[model samples]
Target: MISLEKDAGLWIVTIDRQDKANSLTPQMLEQLCEIAESAREAQALILTGAGRVFSAGADLEAARAGLATSPLWERLSGAIARLPGLTVAALNGTAAGGALGMVLACDLRLAVPEAKLFYPVMKLGFLPQPSDPVRLTALIGPARAKMILMAGQKIPVEEAQLWGLIDRLAPPDSLLAEARALCADTLGASPAHAAAIKAMIR
Candidate 1:
């Protein structure tokens, strides 16, 4: 399930499938992709999940049915990356598998202190979304990216921060609040000014 909330220029998208550890279904992924693609009006976009695990990646049954290799994963991440606004991944908990694609695409990443990030595509015999490795390598470096994608290491929050994988670590209970606070300046800026700065940085 996906929950999208719009407050002025800020967009908050949440994955709301707690029972499934917030794993995404094809429909939910489509909703996310649509939201990302249509969020040109958003000055700041914060993506989060509703439970302890941000996402366990694709829904188990769906992944077994070929969802793991779907082009939707690449489409979703590409849409998020193209958003002309500040895009933040507010990781409430562990982020694994295909979920890492969107996280890597985000402009900034804020994670709970207890959160960990990993992608098991190698072990699962599936290649990651097309853009994931380039983005991940850009943030943390090719060697470190290899450690996670190739060696299958689960990167803890502190280690992640050290490697520049996550920009900040927030208290678990206040993760969203902190993520919102991080967007205050962007939220207050003119849409054109915000978009200009984002484009300049990229």
Candidate 2:
């Protein structure tokens, strides 16, 4: 469900479920958590998804089956979100539901031109994790975060960037490459200094 590659002191994590728009499965999330744990020693980390989407969010069928709230998913997501290193998200396509939460947790996000983001917990008749609102507000400000949560509206890629939701933009095909380049630039600096900077920010 996921692939990990290492190059130039960076770890690239990819969700490889194109047939399902790279939707998050419990198992996939577990693997991602493991990847993030292992990334602690790396200079940087980048996550993306296969095919046209970085992630479409949770598997709805799993939710209907009562598997979405499993403890494993919660633990795994927390591990990925708090990975102790420079973390970057390569938003390769539309990111919604829990996927938006994942992107919001990253230190930096490079979104593709085709990327769109939304928080539709209201529309789904479900509330997002309480911490999501905090992270969303930290990323895009309280006003934008409340608008997304309350209105259940989708924000286009450009608008999301303008709203401070994403740090940079890349072509769909080049999103991963851009992410790698950004990580490379990060790794080019002194690792110790970077770690110190990250610690200070945290």
Candidate 3:
């Protein structure tokens, strides 16, 4: 499930399936892609999760039912990455598996102090989607990326911040508020200049 809210210049997208650790289903991914496409006019966008868990990655049942595919994941990640303005991932809790791709796609990431991040593809006996490793490497470098994707390391928020996987850490209760403040600060930059910088960096 997904919920969208507009606050001033920011569009907030929340994954609301907390009962299942907010695991993403194929349908949910599709919906997110659509939302990302439509949110281009907003000055900034924030992707987060309701309750706690940001996302547990692909829903196992959907994968087992053959409803999940690398292409679908790519579409969702690509959509988020291509957003014209600033994009931020407010990691309210842990992020795992394919969910890492979504977080990486964002221009910036803020996580709660208790949040943890990992990609369990190796432990799950499958390779991460091709683009995932590439994105992770681009953000955190090959060695650390290997530690996460190949060694199946679970990184807590403090280490993640030190490694540049997350930009800031906030207390659980204030995570979203901090993310919104960051977004608001980013709005001080001209949209055109911000977009250009993001494009150049990518």
lDDT tens digits, residue span 1-202, model 1: 8999999999999999999999999999999999999998899999999989999999999999999999999999999999888999999999999998999999999999889999998899988887899999888889999999999999999999999999999898889999999899998889899889988888
Per-residue CA lDDT of model 2 for 68-178, tens digit only, reads 445554555566666656789998888888777667778898988877898788887777765678888887788889889988888998998898888999988778778
How badly does each model clash, as a count of residue pairs? 0, 0, 0
On lDDT, the leading prediction is 1
- In angstroms, give how far residue 150 of model 1 lies from its true place: 0.7
lDDT of 3 by residue, 1-202 (tens): 8999998778999999988999989889889888988877778999999887999988999866753455777777888888878899999999988888889989899998888999887777777777788888987899999899888899998998999999998888888888888787557777787788878876
lDDT of 1 at 153: 98
Ordering by lDDT: 1, 3, 2
State the displacement of the C-alpha of residue 55, model 1, in Å, after optimal TM-score superposition. 0.5
| Residue runs of model 2 more than 4 Å from their true location after superposition | 70-74
- In order, candidate lDDTs are 0.93, 0.79, 0.86
Each prediction's RMSD to truth: 0.8, 1.8, 1.6
User: Which TM-score value belongs to model 2?
Assistant: 0.91
TM-scores for the candidates? 0.98, 0.91, 0.93
Clashing pairs in 1: none
